[model samples]
Target: MHVTKEQIAGMGKFERANFINSLSGMKSANLIGTKSEHGVTNLALVSSVFHVGANPPLVGMLMRPHTVVRDTLQNIKDSGVYTINHVNEAMVEQAHQCSARYDSDKSEFEATGLEEQYFNDFAAPFVAQSNIKFAVEVREIQVLQLNQTELVIGEIVGVLSNKDYCLEDGYVDIQAAGSIAVSSLDSYHRTERIDRYSYAKPDEPLRSIWKTQS
Candidate 1:
């Protein structure tokens, strides 16, 4: 555990990757369930979904270098639209299966038991069981040369959720929604909201801490 990284590169590629994976944060990407140009459906698992700005409701996600093999990236490139499905404990198995390399003619929906549903005007299908889901239109794509990941920014057009999951101030309880997170490469976990706070400072009073006296 105390080994230096500079000394590890001499070990090998897999060793370097294993070291990085152990230290990385849990990144859960929103899988974009989409339809290809020829009507072939594509389920692409992504590792990057970030909230860029809230004014216009912008969100960002990155696709891997294999934009060539994944049709979801191409479909969004062509149609400028896609859906983001939240992965929960109940759906993680099926969602993870989507990361596999399937034939262009096969649909992840058909390949897996996970249900898919479409909206009135949107041609792409969204995960039917996702407690929190959104339809997004592609706004821009930025290619990062460092890793060849295409950072895609999108505008949320539609949102669907169970009414009970919403807070009085309009923030959805993602933990209550059962939205899960993706760990480094192939691991998934459920998130639990420990507390909801208004504001805080390092020196501020701590109300929740109980002091013990002997």
Candidate 2:
């Protein structure tokens, strides 16, 4: 149970990777959709997507080292637009299959049987089965000096979600949207909201906000 840096380094490659990845616990599972300038669409399953800021509505995700062929990263760089679609429970199998390595000419949408959707003439494709999805425009990309991994930061240009899941105060009930979470690289899980709390004040007791939401 006690694992040190030296111990981790001594572990098998696959074992270390799995252990380190799962240490972060459950992560948002999303399908990043992009299209090459040549019109070849690509879909990649990633768990690294995260919120960068709320005021400017920025989002970010980390791309593995670019030493090998990375179609999604390349397409985003070439086109500057991409779609992030939540992987709902129903689409887990199809979404996970997108992680498979495919040739540049191959479209994961076609290979996985997931329907591609477009909106407002956006160049990137979205997953038709996803209940919640959004389009992003690349704002910046930085290559981390330590590991050569790339950090992609983008602005959310538009969002598409079911109205039923959108709360009065602007909180999107992802659980109600049937979105699933991922652990490590392959495991998938559904989530339930235990309760919601109001913003904490110095000495004030936190109040349950879930009961007050319309």
Candidate 3:
């Protein structure tokens, strides 16, 4: 169906969110981040983990506008730390529960019965049950008021993973990871890798190099 921007802009917030969400389908890992505080401060789920660069291991995520003051965003602003956890098919139900619209005083970890593993100096608690986890310090946050979204950058200071899921060359076997992929918005699916390739030098006259070298 052909739809114009002006026409789509007329839809309600929920409708627009749904439409955009549908367009995105399943996003990356729906991470649960908690604040670094005296006791457990805040817990929330986000679905926006993305890579920015490889040189310094940078990661990014997004925070949407809050119906009420958002503690996760606020806490990240205050404490400058957060955590990220990967979701598996088995935890989808509980992971989905982490998305509930709870008050700032509420903790989704406690609400969903997910255990938080506290570290020696980690500002935020890690999701102990998750096969993969990351402890990050907020590098910068760009607030895009026009879109009502925040682009947060974090320096990956710590990383943890289950050994069995990794390969010798640092490749991850998705089939063993048992992770789900999202498409168009709310849809979820799995990913599989079927091939590998290597490149050849341009000046090397193709097959004449390897055998003729002798």
For candidate 2, the lDDT comes to 0.92
Report the number of the highest-lDDT candidate. 2
**1 against 3, candidate with superior TM-score:** 1
For each candidate in turn, give its C-alpha RMSD to the true structure in angstroms: 4.5, 1.2, 5.4
Writing each residue's lDDT as its tens digit, candidate 2 over 102-182 gives 888999999999999999989999999999999999999999999989999999999999899999899999999999999
TM-score of structure candidate 2: 0.97
Q: Could you give candidate 3's per-residue lDDT for residues 123-200 as a string of tens digits?
A: 788876777778889899999888878888989988777788776766655446666666543455666654443346
TM-score for each predicted model, relative to the true structure: 0.87, 0.97, 0.81
Tell me the deviation in Å of residue 169 in model 2: 0.5
By TM-score, the candidates rank as: 2, 1, 3
Q: Which candidate would rank higher by TM-score, 1 or 2?
A: 2
Candidate 1 error regions (>4 Å): 11-15, 67-69, 201-203, 206-214
- The lowest-lDDT stretch of 10 consecutive residues in candidate 3 is 205-214
